[model samples]
Target: MKHTGFRIAVIGAGAIGQTFAESLLQGSIGEIAFMDLREKPDFLSDERYGRLTSIHELVAWRPNVVVECAGHNAVTTIVPSVLREGFDVVLSSVGALANPKIRTALCSSAVAGGSQLVPIAGAVGGIDALSAAARSGLTEVMYTGRKPPRAWSGTAAAQEVNLDTLTSQKVIFAGTAQEAALKYPANANVAAAIAIHGLGFEKTRVTLIADPAIRLNCHEIYAKSRSGELRVNMSNEPSPGNPRTSWLAALSLQQTVLNKVLGAQWAA
Candidate 1:
């Protein structure tokens, strides 16, 4: 519905951040302030929106939630501090939690400040079903991520295979979700999201493929639990601004924010 005074602080002014901001503005859900190291984008020049320099500045702006879309480094360094300030964090870089220490720290910080770390289901579906099945005890969870060869550039996948000459799908990595997320931080966020919701990092199996035949990023997930078996497949177009990420990722974060804000409104 109408969130009159709600505010959101977004970390990172990149593609995802901009998209989320635009979506909020279009829906008139909340005001937005961006905390980023880079120069402010033209769209954020409006005086109503804030361009913050640090976490302290962002906290001072008094946002109901802080959304992290910068990357793994921001998740490690910025998110915990924001959470410790008692602001709920909508995390886009779920892959960063692959590091046990970072995950633990974020959890401790959230507990310390009485805030919550909300990880959105980015570039994938079936998270709600998987998370529900987890309570009933899941036996197995597997995720396969396939994307265009250019999408795998600059990541560990590029080093593992010749992305330029690949004519067919090549399995670049096959391991636990933790290993895959750690090695391919930019590409395996869906795997991490699956692990977090289903069988956790160690138990969730992950396979990453670089395919020359595909123009879209594809995600396939399979899980088995006492409740039943589940299979999901999604084909996502890469963001026009950044091929490394799916266009749906930004929209997912936007939906997460809306759900949080609306849920709060309903409870109130």
Candidate 2:
């Protein structure tokens, strides 16, 4: 199918959101617009794009697809409204879906509007395999996230371990995916993806670590199921503009946009 005149709106103008807007524009996907809460809008007068102040305006403008690169709060505040308008959405904040209320409302809105909610596979791989194994019944799923000690600053990890004085790796948190997402909202997307794809949030286990040795963020997944076993490990460089998010996440969002515009299938 030709996406000759497809119109897309992006939520947020932060590191991830701005990255998605520029990437989509460069790819010539369509007329790229943004919905944000900025006091002033960026890239609004480029002639190739536009911007809106609220979800109401975004819905009124009627975009073909909405790519949400904003944080979890956007998932609760903006995404449901978009889906309720019958527009498809690409959700980057997978961690937000761990909230039962938000997940239910988003899914219900999508169903009511006949839209699809596509989840981006950020900072990790092998999700296709893990999700497939789940079909046969997954026995267990574990996700471990490790990052530089400095990155854990301002998070609960700071209270558990001294971020500046930590010498070696320290296990900061260990629990279910739900708890991980709630406790570390900024660093929960990967764990949430593993849980949502391979198992429910309550059943999937999570471990978080603060390492003084590593600059790059790392994610590891282990899963066992009736069909087979799966293990995936990846180290991701942080986004230049946002240390809290992986650069790979922006790339994944780009791929999700391509999948929708090109009418191609994405395994994850």
Candidate 3:
């Protein structure tokens, strides 16, 4: 398809959000704009870009796509409004999709407007293969996420166990992807993506860990289908600004924006 540069509005200025916006501008793909609750970040340095301020302002100057780099609250509030106005969206916060009613509403909005809301593969890989495996009737899929004990400091992990004393791997949380996403929203983006893609949320299993030994965030997935089995693992370096988010997550957002703007997309 021939391309007219897309008007992109990012919805957060945190590490992942800024990284995605910076990467997009660096590649010279689209006109970079941002929408956040906070003031314009000095990083982008473009007056045309800044905080969106309110939903009214966002609808007033509608962009082709709005990347919801913010959290689930943004998804529940801003994203629906944007979608209802016929704007497609790239949702980096996959955990928000765990709310079945919210997911249905968002899907309806996209369909009503003839647009799309896509989930980015944040930290994990093997999603394409895992999803393909699903079509063949997969049996088992599990996602284990591990981050440093200090990394889990602010989270409920501290309450579950003594994160400071953990010397080896410890599974602090075990449940369905839905529960995982709800309890570990900031940390379960990749796991939620894997669950939604492989088997519906209820069928996918999740394990959360606080590892004292590993400095970087880690993600691993194992799946067995009628076709066969696949195992994928990655130890991710956190985004410079947000230690909780994987660097690859921001890159995925930027790359998707590039495909939308420049019409150059990588094959899976």
**Pairs clashing in candidate 3?**
none
> What do the candidate models score in CA lDDT, each in turn?
0.91, 0.86, 0.82
Backbone clashes for every candidate come to 0, 0, 0
Candidate 3's displacement at residue 49, Å, is 2.8
The 10 consecutive residues of candidate 1 with the worst lDDT sum are 40-49
Query: 60-121, model 2: which lDDT tens digit per residue?
Result: 88887899987899999888888888999999999998899999999999999899999898
Least accurate 10 contiguous residues by lDDT in model 3? 259-268
Runs off by more than 4 Å, candidate 1: 39-43, 46-48
Global Cα lDDT for candidate 3: 0.82
Candidate 2 has an lDDT of 0.86
**What is the lDDT for 201 in model 1?**
97
Query: Per-residue lDDT for 28-85 in model 3, tens only?
Result: 5556667777665676576645556777777676676788888998898888878888
TM-score of each: 0.95, 0.92, 0.91
Which candidate leads the pack in lDDT? 1
Which candidate would rank higher by lDDT, 1 or 3? 1
Ranked candidates, highest TM-score first: 1, 2, 3
Please report the TM-score between candidate 2 and the true structure: 0.92
